[model samples]
Target chain A: MEENKKTCLHDKHVALGALMSPFGGFDMPIQYEGIIEEHNAVRNACGIFDVSHMGEVFISGPQADAYVNYIFTNDILSVEPGQCLYGMMLHEHGGTVDDLLVYKRNSNDYLLVINASNIDKDVAWIMKNAEGYDVVIDHRSDELGEIAVQGPLAEEIVQKVLGLSLSHLSFYTFGEFTIYGDKPAIISRTGYTGEDGFEIYTDHESTRRLWDELLAAGAKPCGLGCRDTLRFEVGLPLYGDELDDDITPVESGLSMFVKVDKPEFIGREAIIKQKEEGPKKKVVGLEILDRAIARHGAEVLDADDNVIGTVTTGYRGISVDKSIAMALIDARFAARDTQLKVRVRRKVFPAVVIAKKFYKKSYKK
Target chain B: MSKIYYAETHEYIRVEGNEGYVGITDYAQKALGNVVYVDMPEVGDEFEAGDDFGAIESVKAASDLICPASGEVVEVNDALVDNPRLINEDAMKNWIIKISISDEAELDDLMDLEAYEKYLESNPH
Candidate 1:
């Protein structure tokens, strides 16, 4: 078995007595103080996350814009420089390769931020499809470290602690700046949590220094445990849970990100076909009536106890104060207010279909 | 005072006559972090030794509660139904279920408090 990789701040996490666990090939922190405490910190105040495991790839050259649009589901042509668009790279059969953020630096230069687990697969897929296009693909998964400072006070904390002015940057936008005298850094007004936040990418040394400074400034050090809960509550689809090689963006309830109207793109035909024919399964929200948490892989059943779907993610929501889950169920049972059941072990808890967003997103729009 | 015994899986049984109060150990609760829910068996449920009677869910994952002795559940911890954090506060006090031990011989197989502490020392988490 291959040994798990460690980030630059792995020692810091250990020093703080964090619960370390393996995630996406990296030995990452699962929680610092506790999951509930860290989760509440992110929702009520600022929390810092070590997101360096995320992959970064730079696509440049004249064909970068068109090439990105071809591989990605979203229309990159619509976004201007310094703006980032969230979309997925899809297989020809409409299954998701990975959901990612495309930062359009210029007409010919773009940066693609992909999930940590899909780094190798995404880079290989991009290279294989780069056959005729004149695009330079720079895979920088290891060269940089990233951190997300999230919550309502993120803007103030970033400005006060990091010395970065984010008042001008709107949501889903990025700006390049120099840190520690000539070290290039990218700060983006984007995050997975529903709150307003910024993701800062810089060299490993600078990242370590920045992490120390942010911690000193009282930004809570969060881990992947709360990250999952926060994102799930906001209805953000995790790569493995809400999407996979077999699940399409349309079926994941992410059709808004997949621009099928675009004349050409990988999996466009399949996506359009699925859109026309209607999806067989759909990702929806379930509010379990009981406190018993219906976890991932738990069976979702119809009234008659027939298995109809599987839970992708579920939690006893800290902010929402209820048992909620996101499940991929048959499209026939996807409507809101539809009664269902989730078999959480020996017992089946009553559930009702609701809008996927269990918590209102507090983005600084 | 009841005599306490522990299973390798971290469950503890406090024996008082033929009845044993079953709950997870303090180490188990500390390891599990915050307790969000407790899936308890209904009263009168019978279980063989080592059978999973219920589950204790934290914020991140769930762990099954294994029975340390053959028994029939006489009473379930109704307090855990609404607030599972009672275990986290004091695992020894917040018993998950009170069971009538069907086979007292099974108690010989469990570790005493001293032996359980030694076991924890030898097997560090």
Candidate 2:
């Protein structure tokens, strides 16, 4: 493959002594201080991450709500102004095309944040299915960028740096905020990691300034390597891993987003059918019995040596003190405490099924 | 006296007076990126030099530890369980295992510090 692309903060990453690597068609920092150190920084204090590579699509026009509800698996009509809803964009066959969060800035304009690698395909899918809809879906990936400020003390640091008060910012809410005098930013109380955080969307040139400002305010710069580890520990689903084109939100235990009770939506009938008849397979969490890791594509086998499923994402849980993984297994064996074996390289290590979440999300009251 | 030998799988053993210390070289640890876990051998395990002894797991991958010399394990550094980083800190000082070398002649087949350093440069992981 060609070398991965670079983000707006590519030069800043190198100057901060980051280890560079390729991710999602971008040459990104795998770590700044190191994976463990950065991971700990975000868990304990606050960390600033250059997530500019995340794609943003602007969907507008009078028929925005109709277009969004038809494409995503959620009740787009229910999202209030200045609110965001998390859901999956499903294919006609009911499998996940991409998992995204659509922010309804108002009745007419909305923003969709999607996984970087799926941006092109997602736009293509939306446009292809947009027949007869009086709406415009514009790809704004290059026009704007994003940064995530996350951790326990993140809110205080954010208020201090941005000169704004977050006194009553409810979870999953967003607002138009000003930073650096004239630069405009959309601040959303959202994050992939199960922590207190905000995603700041701003113009491309202004993103680097915000990154430097946040860093100078004492927020440690983190990278995707620790970001993956952090999100894995929190048991978040990744697009290419715990989810994919062949995986449906219902089978992945995300039926909460696929509301069949809504008037009507894409993948609704298929999801309801699966709900009634039961899914063929389910995504499950695996806790390794030992230190041996179960990596992506590792086989999951039963006691009879029958192949049941494959590991999608695996990592060393710094807090849990053992290897953890998420695997999509036969529904019969998806229950917690089910005994299984993970084929790690040449060895078949024992594992056990557990709750869907590897770690609990401690949402602030 | 001192003698050195290596397993074809890239582990080194330094033998001295019926005893030897075992560890992967600096090159091996560097190749394994961010060591996370080191499964240590027990205090008393008998094994041939080329047998599968333990494992070293990094965030990116895992490699089996091969006995570099024929010996009975006398002691194992259990500290590496939580802090496998001891491997990267000082692979030689923080020996993974102490073994009672069963044979002295096996030392003649291994590389010395100079040869092993050259061996690492000549080959890449």
Q: Lowest lDDT 10-mer window, candidate 1 chain A?
A: A157-166
Q: Which regions of candidate 1 are displaced past 4 Å?
A: none
Model 1 per-residue lDDT tens digits across residues A1-365 = 99999998999999999999999999999999999999999999999999999999999998998899999999999988999999999999999999999999999899999999999899999999999999899999899999999998788888887676779999999999988788899999999999999999999999999999889888999999999999999999999999999999999999999998899999999999999999999999999999989989999999999999999999999999999999999999999999999999999899999999999999988
Give the winner by TM-score.
Answer: 1
Provide the lDDT at A94 for model 2: 81
Q: A91 in model 1: Cα distance from truth in Å?
A: 0.6
The single-chain TM-score for chain B of candidate 2 is 0.88
- Tens-digit lDDT string for candidate 2 (A242-271): 778989998888888887887667777777
Q: What pairs collide in candidate 1?
A: none
Give the residue spans of candidate 2 off by over 4 A: B3-22, B27-34, B39-55, B63-83, B94-125
